[model samples]
Target chain A: MKKTSVFGPTTALAAMVANPLAAQDAVGIDDKVNQVFADLTGPFVSLIFAPFPGTSFPWIVMWLVIAATVFTLYFGFVQFRFFKHAVQLVKGDYSDPNDAGEVSHFQALATALSGTVGLGNIAGVAVAVGIGGPGATFWMILAGLLGMASKFTECTLGVKYRNEYEDGTVSGGPMYYISKGFNELGLPGGKILAVVFSIFCILGALGGGNMFQANQAHAQISGIVGDYPGWITGIIFAAVVFAVIVGGIKSIANVTEKVVPFMGILYVGAALVILIVNYDQIGWAFGQIFAGAFTGLGVAGGMVGALIQGFKRAAFSNEAGVGSAAIAHSAVRTKEPITEGFVSLLEPLIDTVVICTMTALVIVISQQMIINPETGSYMLNEAGTAIATVDGNSGVALTSAAFASGISWFPYVLAIAVVLFAFSTMISWSYYGLKAWTYLFGESKTSELVFKVIFCVFIVIGAAASLGPVIDFSDAAIFAMAVVNIFCLYFLMKLVKTELSSYAARLDSGEIKKFTH
Target chain B: MTVKLVVGLDGTETGDRALAFAKDLASKIDASELIAIYVIEWSPFTFQTADENAKRHLRREEEIELATSRIVEPAVSALRKAGFNARGIVRHGDVAETLDKLTVENEGSQIIVGRASADGFTKRMFGSSTQNLVMHASVPVTVVG
Candidate 1:
């Protein structure tokens, strides 16, 4: 075990763990767990993250970027062209009172945004800027803009091919679209592709959605309260999640829905305050972003490195093409399938373009990152991690340090935000996973319970142990979903184009009435 | 002159008293009518999960159906049987806004609504729907105690 810091908030439990005897046992268990998962998931992780031959770029990132670009062109820059209409749709300006029973465009957008706008904005951007330098922010914004097109295509397809049950509930996602959309096009492998996507979705929910979130939440809490066994936090979290998901305690869920958004606002508000305070540095920060994009600020691989990190994190952050947002959007009540698509494109804008940019700016402006005056690049430690002025901080800690620089009490606020973000993410992903589970096993109460139990168990494991391979596998599973989703989107692009054209014609003809001015 | 009194019903004893008062007032006036309106209070502002959002429309529909059947229909039929021209309206929105909007739509000259005991903290702090309607309704509002 690493030596406890002199000024660390070490409780009795922490002190006991710091004792050599207890420390050895804890390390032994962690090592054993890591060894098992790493060995098991090693090949799959390598295959997923494997770089292109003679380059550091992961092919999956290229896959998403290429697909997003194609959709942008094919849809005639739909994200930009329909931007105003999208806002109108969200504002209930075009929503007929007769169509009031289904999910509002605003609610669907909010639900989808909640799922995407969590740790990726907070920690993921920090990681991107820390390693890839300020240049990553520029590429992140560009990638986010392109991602809106991807969101447009998938969500349009999702609503076009959703399953409406007798009881009024509906389900849709890449799995539904891939299967039904391909079948409609007289393709044979739609079912198989959908099954593959579902399997990946379930795993992604467990690893990235559950485990990674639990791990990060624990990290943030421990940073504030004191170091202790992570299982203590995990068990407490699992109990609460269980009460919400299994026990059907809607009060907890309701409070969370209200609270999470407030937390999001608080986070953005804090970022804005910090940015406004450093009014002079705003220009210099943008200069760093622009300069670093091309020149790399002396970082390795420079521009290319920055581009790769930006694209990867933006894709992960907004999840524009991952098809998860499609499931949420599919439930909206609209006569035209294309309206939800318009509404969904704003998700990437809000998540990556607005929120993620705030985080990147705060990190860039705060100057927590140590730069070598001579080399004009970030100073690196022995492990090659970007050494912050705080010393040894990275990820959320680096972000915390950056925010704490401006507001001394920001870390406490950040800790609350992180925990809330993690909790909300887990709740959202549990629903996503349950949907996938029911699709595969046929929607039975027992099957859903099984998945929820397994998910909560994984949360405990995630918090208790540091399993790198497991997290890697979780990330791979999510991108693996993108791999399947984007490929299917290529075949189904024509359907979306036709729908958009028809909707546009009717809209121009005033067949679709605006309910509000 | 035809006087249309829009009465807000909540399927409570207080609502019955409001309807009875509206009926008595209409009886005393020539060519008067009673429009029983039940507002299923709802706001689009509340955040929901994907699953809950998916089912929101159905829930709203169910609420409308229930209110029409249980509250508005029964009261309107009774008013009709008592020899008053009556109709029922049910909508999902804020109570004061929906009631006032329904009144204006029907060209109502007066709004009659039951004033339930406003005991809750939020009600005390922000004022009840009856208070809101009396303060802001376009037509005259009668708060039946």
Candidate 2:
């Protein structure tokens, strides 16, 4: 007898059995859409993600890394110097009682954190470990640390140049800073750069920020709930997203904001449990990660391969130099723009350093990577890729398998977390995309609705098919945003430094006072 | 001797009854004053999305206006017209804490609040604002049931 499952759509099952052609056609659609998207996005994706000459390293990854390194140097390692101060600011120790109505630094950080700390941590880290080998973990941490400076530089500009309307509402991001900061510096083409950034922000919102999230969520759900058409999940997600963004159902967003943090805590708790269970193997896992980072553990491309993957996944996960987080941080209620900058640095730390590391460690300690004793590296197959215990799986599936290996029921909890994370990310990105959309098209009800509808449609497309081209395009679009943003950051960074020094002088002079409650 | 009374208002009938009780108590005492306070329960730590967070300042302003004009000021005006020295205060925080703080700041001899109906399961599980004020206030609290 055929197994009955609630997750299996009865109509889809009956149709597939009654006519095998229908099943074949459904797969064909998934592939055909992927093929068409690949053709359309290929040139752009190649251009943005092009590898550096004679290396597998993508130039975009290098762009982000170099920018992070520059910011780290330019700011004199502010991420390290003021790390303690950043925590105090977030704790509201420096906040004045008079600033009660304004958005708190903690609120800004949490909003930005929700946007960055999603599938990238759960799935992106898995792909990094799966392909780049355990050694990638070291570079990932390094990138996250360096990325903190990048966040500080951009977010400071975001707050400084934010637009405050008469009604007391605000709008800010790279667009404002690029145009305004450039003008302030007497630089030409600031407006043009800002326009270019808005274009990429819209595309990225639809692709990486919306579709990629939707796609991964579907992948995790289908992995657990039995096979069903991706469109079903896509449509459901799209509908709920539409209702929240367009229908003005704030309750959903409120509920998501309340729930996602709990889910994040649950995810970390589960990871801690798994680590405790493998307590004896913790040191061994760290050794594998550190050794694999340098030696490559027989993984493809050796040490360099691990480095590229580590840097790539870390940038994708934390989104430090990408400038998306600055949009969220700009809303912070602080008289000193650098306070938001200080607070914003914590996003990469929590997202990549803390959460992504947790994911990577779990995968490493799960016994997924078989060591080749002869080579003192990971065992590889004929395909020249390290063999994973879970064959033919990557992304959240790999992470899920790792967690399930620890506690058999962790996959269910992981599935719920993935959906919530995806949903919350979409909500935050919808606002981000809407801001970009309005910046280009002007803020109007009609313009907002148009962008919201377009965003929801992409969610469906992302869910309906296996998206190789879409994923590539999404990565490209986001990197393209960095290209414009990091360039502008170079121009505006001096201004941010000026703001920082002024703030420091004021604090030293006791012009800025800390409050205790 | 002069007596000062503080009335916690929620803009509801229960609050009106509490204000009336406080008003009568003030009238009976020579050289007494009434302080009507309305607190909008709020915490900065609650999770808010970027959109909501962006508009938080505007929302806070609107809430203060609403509580002052619609709840606190109107009630205080009526008390003032009745020949009593009355002033209203609006703040954001835990209801019980804000009221207790107001009482302390105003140098009130007594605090008065309506017995709010059990709001929900959580409110019932934890005591309501009046119950909390009665338990923790620095001054004598009068529950105008």
Candidate 3:
């Protein structure tokens, strides 16, 4: 068995059997950094991921999924109720051109979409379907549907408790409201939860947000060109990211805001084309998904496996329960906080329900995953659920292979898309990490600069390192963010409900002004 | 009767020319108040993270202070040195709309703006604020070259 630093001998052996690259990537931060990250984060990952004695499901995923189910019912399915109003809000039907926040409802939605509409839609979906099989797609869609209420609940509270300064800019998310809302309600633990949330936010920003993006981007780029060391990709990616973020040029940021959406449309449009071309097989693919979800066909762990994979990917994909999007959505320019909440419901609907579903459909319809025609089972390694690839490929490579089936040239486009998604996601997370950093350390210019530099350095670490354990730990850190933020969300949901009712009443009475021109 | 003349600050040669012209007009008019106003073009519709937006809010305040010291304060001081009642206020929004709002809000009698040199695609794209002010201002607008 090929031994890697972070992954134990058992995981390394299994991954090596599934993917040869796990054995081949020799140049990684497998020495000191890997050990340190693992030492610090390993126990937490184990605890958070500890499955029920008889099941393959992790408890943390259950935390988010169950909470989503609860919020979905408690909010009276606000995700469905406000569905049309959310569209109208995005169209600016009720915006008073004179409202006092930093961004329009549309811009806030677009910006927040950019943050979550990254590797999750492309690579994460592949990971889900790779392990869970086509049946997982059904569960994913269901989770995304329920997760919409989770997003609506948190983001509404985001706007209601946002801190609007004298200069017309607003700062918020779960951090502001978690503390403030709980304090108002005379509940204790707001301060502690907020502090823990920020700490996890910074770690998440560094790991899943930064490292994972860089690592995946390196994977895609190196596949096309000859394999180079990951640090080379890391440096170039970090330099460009540093310029857009620290350089503080309006034109550059403006171009990024414009470019990210354009890229998203292009990626989805390509998937749509493939789906259209394979229209006849679409019905058959749905049949397999539904059947596979229930019976799991010959898939390992059967129905339970599909359910777990679907819920996990969908939660991270739209980030509905994670509370990160609340930070971005909180800046919407409207006096009625519920308006932004309505706009935010569209985030998961697009990221998970729309885009992620598209990816799942393409993967399913492409017929790329080798199914033993005789056995009606996905061709996979016996040791693990991973679909075996030529070079032991997984993630984006598997997704790329599926796309390449119909359009031979699409992998090149996907490579470009992956890089763009990675870059934009990094930029978004840099800001998120910085806010949390400044929150913990004083918000001085020097403290912020120190955090920025440290963040840029981790990009290199992520790109260069093939430490599987480090990546796992990073994923755990990110989930930990949801743990803390969602706790606050449960408490502050009452505040959001209050705001929603008031905004609905005002709308019925025609109290809110609409900008016509 | 004292008249209030609002001059839009553009921070260009034309802006300087408009200010000089306004100074002369203020002197010629029997009793007049010349208000030098600089309006920053800001859109709350731009996509930015909460932290960036918060830092940007702080930056705008600093910019307003800097603009007052570097642009408006000198012009106002020059107007005072040239013998006139003058004050400056900096606001943020679409330049034309803000200047128009300032004139109405401050009860100015007339508006004077520099003819922006921007033309071609940029003019079509962004639309010259000077042109908008001339077209939409309720008060009489004097376009200074």
**TM-scores for every predicted model:** 0.94, 0.93, 0.80
Provide DockQ values for all models, in the order shown.
0.67, 0.70, 0.26
| Predicted candidate 3 versus true structure: per-residue lDDT over A1-517, tens digit per residue | 0001111223223333444675455423265666887788789989877887898888877888888899889878888888988888887677664442335687778778889997788888888888788888899999888888888888888878877767566667777788899999999988788889888888888888898888777776766774666778999988877776666665666677777788889888989999999999999989988997887755667888888888888887887788788888876656677777778888878988899889889888887777887987877765766654444545766778888887899889888887788888888888778767776786677998898888889898888766667777777777888989887888788887788778778878987656563
- Poorest 10 consecutive residues by lDDT, candidate 1 chain A: A1-10
CA lDDT of A402 in candidate 1? 90
Error (Å) of candidate 2 at residue A235 is 2.0
Clashing pairs in 1: A101-B57, A102-B57
Instruction: Tell me the deviation in Å of residue A31 in model 1.
Output: 3.5
CA-only RMSD, every prediction: 3.5, 4.3, 5.8
Best by TM-score: 1
Clashing residue pairs in candidate 3 (N, C-alpha, C atoms within 3 angstroms): A19-A392
Ranking by lDDT: 2, 1, 3
Docking class of predicted structure 2: medium
In candidate 3, clashing pairs total 1
Ranking by DockQ: 2, 1, 3
Clashing residue pairs found in predicted model 2: A135-A293, A297-A377, A297-A378
Residue B65, model 1: lDDT of: 85
